[model samples]
Target chain A: MALRREEILESARVLFNRWGTAHVSANRIASDAGVSPGNLYYWFPNKAAIIRALFAEWSAASTGVALAGLADSGDPGDALREFVHAAERQPAATARYAFFPRELFALLHADPELAAAYRRNFEAGVDAITTIAQAGIDAGLLIDPAPRANLRDVVVTAWIASECAPAFLEVIAEEPASGRGSGLAGAILRSLLTDEGAKALDERKGARGHEHRGIRAG
Target chain B: MALRREEILESARVLFNRWGTAHVSANRIASDAGVSPGNLYYWFPNKAAIIRALFAEWSAASTGVALAGLADSGDPGDALREFVHAAERQPAATARYAFFPRELFALLHADPELAAAYRRNFEAGVDAITTIAQAGIDAGLLIDPAPRANLRDVVVTAWIASECAPAFLEVIAEEPASGRGSGLAGAILRSLLTDEGAKALDERKGARGHEHRGIRAG
Candidate 1:
């Protein structure tokens, strides 16, 4: 039963990615999953239910894993980069979930329950980034631009900007594929850093470069 | 006839703002407008047409005026601030159009013509900002961060971030009203400015302060 449900979700994700959530139907999802309509119904009551399941799995995989890595990382700057890199690599993992971010507001407005769940996940992600910022401050690697902005707000704003800028620009600007914005997250992060924070980030990048070379040499 | 059309549009905007585009029916909109359904049909054949009209009006009010101002402004820094300030003030002018930014992707996917029109307006807006950036460079008030980052990309990214960040964060984070991120657009713009650009901005801010004081004293 679990295997069958996963199969249905996989099929829905593919279709939803290609045609978007509005155009795809339950029947199409069922057929694509190679399951009888009855069997599909047994696992999922409707198309919305399938979408909810997909979101649940995606939220867990994306935010959940990033939070865990953030908690485990020793370097705050590295953790911040890893978090963004994880989100950046998500497209390769499943381009099918692109609709989630693309239609985020519509989906949330349509489903209050899903919205509530998604909100919790999003908050958790923001909180994780905030923790990293705090860690940077405590380590003397970050300076607070006090009286001007809050550390948490700066970090959250940067994360949201990085995550949404590309998608928003693509939708509104109709930018060419080659013209897609890149490294915006890193740039925003760097802009928020103090001189000390910037130095630390540079050192981390240098260390990572050396590690990459050592691996190749090995 | 024009007055009645405006009345209908006003009514539709109110209801759409309150209930979103999908839930509101033509009948409800007609009744709210105090017009018969026949009259409503005469003006707009369907709900989709009404949405398109709303978008057209919004595009004109929001982007059109800002582009004109950008063209007129002698100072690139002031022009950038004006463009952002105009967009920021729009929520007060008519929060009804919040739906346009909120459901941007979904609306675009559903209506190709609306999408095309919106794309054109968005590109024009970006181009205006790019021109301002070029002017800043020509005046030696802004330095190109070339070999590191593209000025146009940074400006566009900052603009998109500023326009979309507050709404996106509000929706996803369920952030409290008091906890809202403020001055994000200005902060981002400041971050992208060269030292010379930053100094010029500070001097302009000081001049504006004295002008306000002079007006009050008079």
Candidate 2:
């Protein structure tokens, strides 16, 4: 007779993305999910908990999907290429995925617990990208002297920006590259990878990718 | 007596810093400023209008201040120092001043009048930055095959990123620099401004700054 935890989260995601975390109340979420507030609370202790759960779910899914794309491939750079192609289909979901700051503003200011959790989640993301970059370097894939801190920042930052740009460009229009994150990611990939790495990536789909060519020649 | 419009905007600035755009409503704004919704309505048509008014007010003040700091100096690049310093203090205002995407989303999508206004407003902002970049080139302070389009797009994109970063970072604390629109503004300034421009910019106090210098170096 009661809605499942999954149902509640699915409904909450819809509402949270549309209305915002601040405007959506527990009652509204439960109502949208076709459940009572008590049931929603049973699964998520509070709105903050719901948000945390949502972040954990999306983070695991996004990172897992991206990483999985890279796992089986022989060429780490190509794996990353495959990963980029996979991330493009879920534009709205990706856009929603990146819309945390509006909600985070109040939570981080008020709740130490939320802030710490947020810090850990993002650091993990950066580390994930760092690991991928390290692998590329070890395999003789990437260039520009693999600087750990900077490259990690670049990839993780790119992941977040790529997710946000769709909705953002839905309004501003000029910001989105035709390849979405792929082009930017490729540019970043080229920036950090070696000549062999670049060749491998360009030949990922067995074509000479032009992102590498677009870099200004000075 | 009704609350004065300037007083309302200034108070809204404080509220925005603390509560953000979503959590705080016209009702709270009216009450905080010791007026009624009706009184506030006389000054601002809606919550978004209040936000828009604040944007205009803050942009007018900050832009004028930054411009004056530049104009008084013979060297345009030197003036850009004031611009950078101006940026650090101004993030709080920038974050508060723009309507958060969630709030801006519907109006941007549906309201034709607001959409046109949005376009004009955005174009104006881009034009201002382009003009600054052009002036440096004209003075032989900047090196550019084409100053106007290049500088404007870079500035517009980066400023939007900076404007949007706090919200994005609030959600994704792991990547604070994700939406930093102006992150590349200085680099564009440096790359386009040849030796003469760099010399001029160097003369200004606090002219040179970089959060991730490596992002632009490659």
Candidate 3:
């Protein structure tokens, strides 16, 4: 049952990403999944239920990768760089769930249960970012000169920019692939950093570049 | 005829803003406009046509405000400030057309003519911002040490943040009014400013504060 459910979700994700949720009907999803409508319904009550499940899975996977990156890095700058890179990669990582972000507002407004779940996930994401940013500050690798409330606002703003800007721009502008990495988060982070923090971040980037070259040479 | 067209568009905008474009039907819009369905059709062939018209009007108003602010201000810093303020106020200014931003991608995808118009407007907006940023640099009020491409990218990112961040966050997280002024654009702008630029911006802000106080006292 679990395996079938996963298969159904995978099918739905592909269709949703390709054509969006509104265009793809439940029967189409079942056909795409190579399952009878009755079988698909047995596994998932409705398309909304499938979307909810996919959203939960995507959110968990993204948060898990972010937390893992944080846990693996000892240096605060390195951790932050890793976390941001992970976030930058998230759109591609969950491309199957592309429909979710594009239709996010309408979907959430339509389903209270989904909205509540999404809100919890959003809060968790914010908390994780706050923790990482605070750690950077503690390690003397970040400087936020704003008052407490203002600093929090800046962090949240940076978080939103990093997580949503690329995807949002992609959908709205239909921008070329070359236009993808605006590095808005990096710009925001630079504004928040002390000189020491800037140096540390540069050093971390240099080290990562060297590691990448070493791997390529090997 | 034009007056009735305006009335129908206004009615559709309100309904769309309240309940999204997909859920609001043509008949509902016609009823809300206090017009017959035939009359509504005479003005706008369909709901998409009405949405496109509203979008065009909203874009024109926003771009006009930004350009007028730029043209009026002698100081680059002042111009940038005014532009940001105008952009920030846009969501509220066009609140009745909120569905356009929320469903931007889908709407553009659905209509090539609308997509072309939007692309032109977006490019014009970028050009205006770039011109203002360049003026700031020439006046020694901004420092963008980045290469030409990177500098353009940064400006575009800041523009997107200023224009879309509040509306996007409100819809996604149901964030409070306190969260409204994340000042993402301000942060990005600060990062791009030279020391002199930062000081000039501060002085301008201080002067504006005094002006506000003087107005209140008078």
Candidate 4:
């Protein structure tokens, strides 16, 4: 199948989420996917390349998919709910999405081009969030109308890391994860929401059954 | 000379923050401290022992320091600020605290006891946050009295990680010189302060020589 490469990538992501990049060797990935490690190497040169691919793929789907669906919504509160619901759909898949965001953030330690690309995508998502937030204000649903620096990044980045539990790295004495938040997106949102926006989300309780109750938005 | 152990542990904490335990061999820590690795091993059996000492020492100090300070403060918001600020001061030293935490949650591939300890510490911190939150509600500073679940961990963990920006990790992709948001803790505090709290902070802006023009804290 033309999508075989992507499939391997997908499987690699699964293994990575479960085993981390270190333990889930290419040989293991190949075996899990019913291919040879040699075949895996034919596509990816080494462990680092596979990790890079996983990160790139996650960034593509996450920002693009959620923002695309949320773009048309006039109310930022509704848009945020849609996004949360989307994230909640797959506990495992979403876990995959949350899994490596720490390492992805850590790319700044050694690589500039990679960091720029990450910030660009992150900024793009933030822009979309800011736009929707503006809409909420114009629609009488949001409190503040201004775009604060790193507003979305500060919250969203932390939220993703929390969902991933990057703070749990000390047991293995790891880095980067310590540097990131456990997940404060929802709390940060609460601080920024309009009285109306907060009230609206408050009404959605017990609805949608999304399990990401932490992002209660209020 | 009696302070040697504390000094060794302190030096280890710094190296742990930048290099991570796996990357920082005993020699690196010894050299950084201007001591021999042989002396280091004499005090602690292995790096893991040193890791445990760091956690035990920090946990005891942090858990008691601010709680003692805020014991008489009726306002939970004030206590919460004290708590967060205390954490902000030792962001680097605390990296060792999060070293295993990073693995337990982010990687989810660490030893069981480490993960268990992480959960225990995390829950305790959550309890502390919730206690203050409840106090805030009782004091009439907070509107909603009920915390859905883990509101404290989600909020505090996110802020610290985003703000600390650990070494060897790419999580803080933005350039430090850019001076955006001033790490997650300050950003979160600014983002989540109650309207009243924001006003309190803003009232001092002129005298403090800091501007809060567009910063939303409701």
Winning candidate number (lDDT): 3
Which candidate number has the best DockQ? 1
Q: How many clashes in candidate 4?
A: 35
Model 4 lDDT per residue over B3-66, tens place: 7787788788887766666688877777887778888888887776777777677666545533
What TM-scores do the predictions have? Answer: 0.78, 0.61, 0.82, 0.71
Fnat for each model: 0.25, 0.05, 0.13, 0.20
Chain A of candidate 1 gets a TM-score of: 0.79
lDDT agreement with native, every candidate: 0.66, 0.55, 0.67, 0.54
lDDT of 2 by residue, B1-218 (tens): 44378777777877876666657888888888877788899988987787776655655654653454455355455445455556556555555554443244444544555556666666665565556666666778655433112344345444444444555555544333323443422333444445665555555433245522411110
Model 1 ranges off by over 4 Å: A64-72, A133-147, A162-173, A176-187, A190-218, B64-72, B80-84, B131-148, B162-170, B176-187, B190-218
Give per-residue CA lDDT, model 3, range A1-218, as digits (tens).
67877788989999988888888898998898888899999988998999999989877866764575467456666667666556656656556577776666667767888888877776666677667777777878666433322444555555555445555565555452235553554555554555566666566556664644422100
Task: Specify the poorest-scoring 10-residue window by lDDT in model 4 chain B.
Answer: B209-218
List residue ranges in candidate 3 displaced over 4 A.
A65-69, A72-74, A134-149, A162-167, A172-187, A190-199, A209-218, B137-149, B176-187, B190-218
Kindly give the stretch of ten consecutive residues in candidate 3 chain B with the minimal lDDT sum: B209-218
* Candidate 2 regions with alpha-carbon error over 4 angstroms: A1-3, A15-50, A65-115, A131-160, A171-198, A207-218, B1-3, B21-42, B59-119, B123-160, B168-218
Candidate 2: Cα lDDT at B165: 54
lDDT tens digits, residue span B112-190, model 1? 8888888787678767766776776676655454434455555555656655664575566545223533455445444
Candidate 2 per-residue lDDT, tens place, A123-186, comes to 6655656666667767776432222123443554455444444454555545422233333323
Give lDDT tens digits, candidate 1, residues A167-197.
Answer: 5655665452225334554455444556566
Better of 1 and 4 by lDDT: 1
The CA lDDT at A214 in model 2 is 31
| Root-mean-square deviation per candidate | 4.8, 8.1, 4.6, 7.2
